[model samples]
Target: MDIAIVGGGAAGFMAAITARRTNPSCKVTIFERAQKVLAKVEVTGGGRCNLTNSFAAISDLKQAYPRGYKLMKRLMMTFNHEDAYRWFEEHGVPLVTQDDDCVFPKAQDSHAVIDCLVQQAADLGVMVCCKSRLMDIRSMQDGRLELIFDNGTQRIFHRAIITTGGSPKGNNLQYLARLGHKIVPPIPSLFTFSIRDKAFCNLMGTVVDPVVMTIPGTKFRSKGALLVTHWGMSGPATLKLSSHAARMLAEQDYKSPIAISWTGERSRQEVEENILAMQIANPRKQLATLHPFGLPSRLWVYILSKLGLEAAKPWAEIGRKTFNRMIETLVNDQYTIMGKSAFREEFVTCGGVSLESINSKTLESKVCPNLFFAGEVLDIDAITGGFNLQAAWTTGFIAGSCVAE
Candidate 1:
């Protein structure tokens, strides 16, 4: 069987290797537009290549993906995180989990992971042809797939897999849509909002753990670590919220105001009660000198300043009105988002090939027989951590096994 996989990224390469491993006699070929494979893997996770998450259960793993959570749940039951780790371990690539459950190469080098995939592909007799841009794909009358390359080259294959990733590069989706597959409108995900507030100007390096972030027009809320950058707010919480609200944010022109609760564990009533207790405990002490709720003294002062509270005011001297205002600001701090910042080296997009046209179990297209899809190319995206890469591995493995069968 001749199988041609397009876009030699994580999913494409993995599928090629999996197909060859499942059937040694199968001719597996990967056509990468770039001269190198795993370009994204090299820069992912600051070059460490966060391989897979430590989450073992399919139920918990599905929560990481906002787009295809339900569909991925069924798929992950077949090839979950443990399966991925074992697959790499058996292939001579050992993985170590970080403190946050993100798995990476024990050597902490993305090239090591990339080398493992490349070497494994070679060992499995999978042919990787670089600089071969697939221009078009056509289904022949004899039930074979015909691929036309940019260099005026054409190849016929018994099966083809489209794993060209998202719209980060170009209009690769158009090529696939022309081949009769539905393509979802691509949108940016896992991005930070650019807030137009000076209070967060000097807070570029400040990190707030367990922050509750929410979109204004929606009831979506995420609690995780948040970082205040010079551009705006970022980190796990913001990125996760962005993934779930990518389409909503895009429709609003990225100008929606977001509400942030730094004290994620406490509600407005709880915060007010705590402040009242603090005032009673330290009646004679100045409010500025006593940092309540263990927040940074600087942040406490900033919040007081925003609430128009005098730093030198004694706890007893603070009026009920001012105290209520302070509590309100602390619980429901609002910031107008002006734009979006791609999380430096980390950018996970939310749109790709429509999942409805693909078989969730086999990663094969329902519209075209023998056509499979995997990785970021599908309309599936996850939050930060190792979720995105794990999706790739799972889908790739399934496609490989299905194609080989």
Candidate 2:
């Protein structure tokens, strides 16, 4: 049997290797568009290559995967994070889990991962054809699949797996769309919001943890450490919130109002009580001197300045109206999301080939036999951390395992 894997990425490599392993007599090949393969993997997670997540904090898969939770839940039965962790370690890459539950190679370099995949494929005799962009895919009458490359080369394969990852625009997936698969319009996910407020941007270096951010008139919300960037906010909370609200934010033209609770998951009443206790505990202390809720001093001062409150005033001098206003600001600080900026080198999109058109068990296209999909190309995406890569490994494993069947 001959198998072709298109787009040499995390999923493509994994699929190629798994296919060869599942049916050792089969010949497998990877066709990559770029001059080299695994380009994104080289720079992902700032070059450390976050392989998978421990998922210790995730009781529900939806918490990590904003989209495709149901499909992922089904796929996890065959290959989950634990399986990925074991696979990497058994393959000679030592792994470590950070405090945030993100797993990376102990070597602390993406090359460690790159080397592993390349070596594994080489050992498995998987043919890697770089600079081989697929322009079209057609089902052959003989039950084979024909892959037409940009270079005018055509190849017939018994099975094909599309692991092309996410494309920023719809046209990139046109070939797959021609095959009758439902294509979800691709939109950016896991990005940073661009805030136009110059004053807020001035707090670029400020980082607040355990803060809750919510989009108004929407059910999207995220809680984590938020770093104020020069242009806007970029951090776990912002990235997660962006993932959850990717479609809505895109519809709004990236212009939406966001509500943030400086006090984290604390209720408004709790914020009030905490403020009251702070005032009582430090009656004579200046408001500016004592920051509440373990908030950074600069952020607290910025909040006070925004409220037009005298920073030099003693805590005891706080009036009922001012206290209420303070409580409101602490729990409901508002900001407009003017635009979006890419989160470093990572470009993740939530939209792709909708899962409705694929078999959940094998990740094979329901419309086209012997054609399967894995990774970001399948309308599946997750927030920051290692969830995205986990999706890649699991889906790739499943597709390769069942592609020949």
Q: Against the true structure, whose lDDT is highest?
A: 2
Per-residue lDDT for 310-377 in model 1, tens only?
88989998888888888878888888889988875667777888888888788888878888998988
Error of 2 at 336 (Å): 1.0
Q: Model 2 over residues 1-405: C-alpha lDDT tens digits?
A: 999999899999989899999999999999999999999999999999988999999999999898899999999998999999999999999999999999999999999999999999999899999999999999999989999999999999998999999999899999889999999999999899999988888999899998999998878999999999999999899999999999999999999999999999998888898899999999999999999989999899999999998889999999999999999999999999999998866779989999999998889899999999999999999988989999999999999999855
Model 2 Cα displacement at 237 (Å)?
0.2
Q: List where candidate 1 sits over 4 angstroms from the true fold.
A: 56-62
Off by over 4 Å in 2: none
The TM-score of candidate 2 is 0.98
TM-score leader:
2
* Residue 24, model 2, lDDT: 95
TM-scores of the models, in the order given: 0.96, 0.98
What are the RMSDs of all candidates, in order? 1.7, 1.0
